[model samples]
Each structure stands twice: as C-alpha cells, then as structure tokens.
Target: MVILSGLMFIGISIGLIAVKYKEAYIGLIENRTDNLQTPSVLME
Candidate 1:
C-alpha cells in the first residue's frame, strides 16, 4: 500500500512538471516572436 501511494505521488509530480514546462516553452516562443516583430516595426 505504501508503494502504491508513493507511485501515485510521483505520477502527480511528473504531470505537474510537464504542464509547467509546456507553458514555459510556449511563453518563450511567443516572446521570441514578439521581439522579432518589434525590431521590424521600429525600423519602419
């Protein structure tokens, strides 16, 4: 029973980590695109 509970806790932690990583990855991509566009806009 203890082993099963431990496994469940590990699974939940992994899932939370994955979700946070995905959000961070997407935010980085969006920030990059915004930065790229801003330079072009300033040039014009």
Candidate 2:
C-alpha cells in the first residue's frame, strides 16, 4: 500500500539522518549514561 511504503521510506530516511549525525546523538546518550553509576542501574 502507498501508506505503508511512505512509512517505510520515512523510517529509512530518519535512520540515515541519525547515522549521519550519529556522533552528536551518541554524545547525548553518553551524557545521559554518565548520570548513572553503571549500566546495571538502567535495568532498575
């Protein structure tokens, strides 16, 4: 269906953009993780 195709295309486009700006995204994630003492804290 056209709607499904459009959704897939948008999803792929967003994924590509994330990959292109992965460093910035990863930096954000790293800052978030820094607040936790360890990765196990995330399981809580």
Candidate 3:
C-alpha cells in the first residue's frame, strides 16, 4: 500500500510538471513569434 501510494504521488507530480513545461514552452514560442513579427499561423 505504501509503495502504491508513493508511486501515485510521483505520477501526479510528473503530470503536473509536464503540464507546466508545456505551458512554458508555448509561452516561449509565442514570445518568439511576437518578437519576430511573424504570423502565428506559421507556427501552427
């Protein structure tokens, strides 16, 4: 039970980290696009 709970906690933490990383990555891309004055559709 203890091991299972520990694994669950780790999984949740990883999921949160992944979500945050994705948000940060998208934010960086947006900033770069704005700086370059390029159309955002090009990014897609």
Candidate 1 Cα lDDT to native: 0.94
Best by lDDT: 1
User: Model 1, 1-44: lDDT tens per residue?
Assistant: 99999999999999999999999999999999998877776576
Across 14-41, the per-residue lDDT of candidate 2 in tens digits comes to: 9999897998889889987887656766
Candidates 1 and 2: which is better by lDDT? 1
Name the candidate, 1 or 2, with the larger TM-score value.
1
TM-score of 3: 0.77
Segments of candidate 2 deviating more than 4 angstroms: 23-44
Q: After superposition, how far is residue 18 of candidate 1 from its true place, in Å?
A: 1.0
TM-score of 2: 0.51
Q: For candidate 3, lDDT tens digit of each residue in 1-44?
A: 99999999999999999999999999999999886896667578
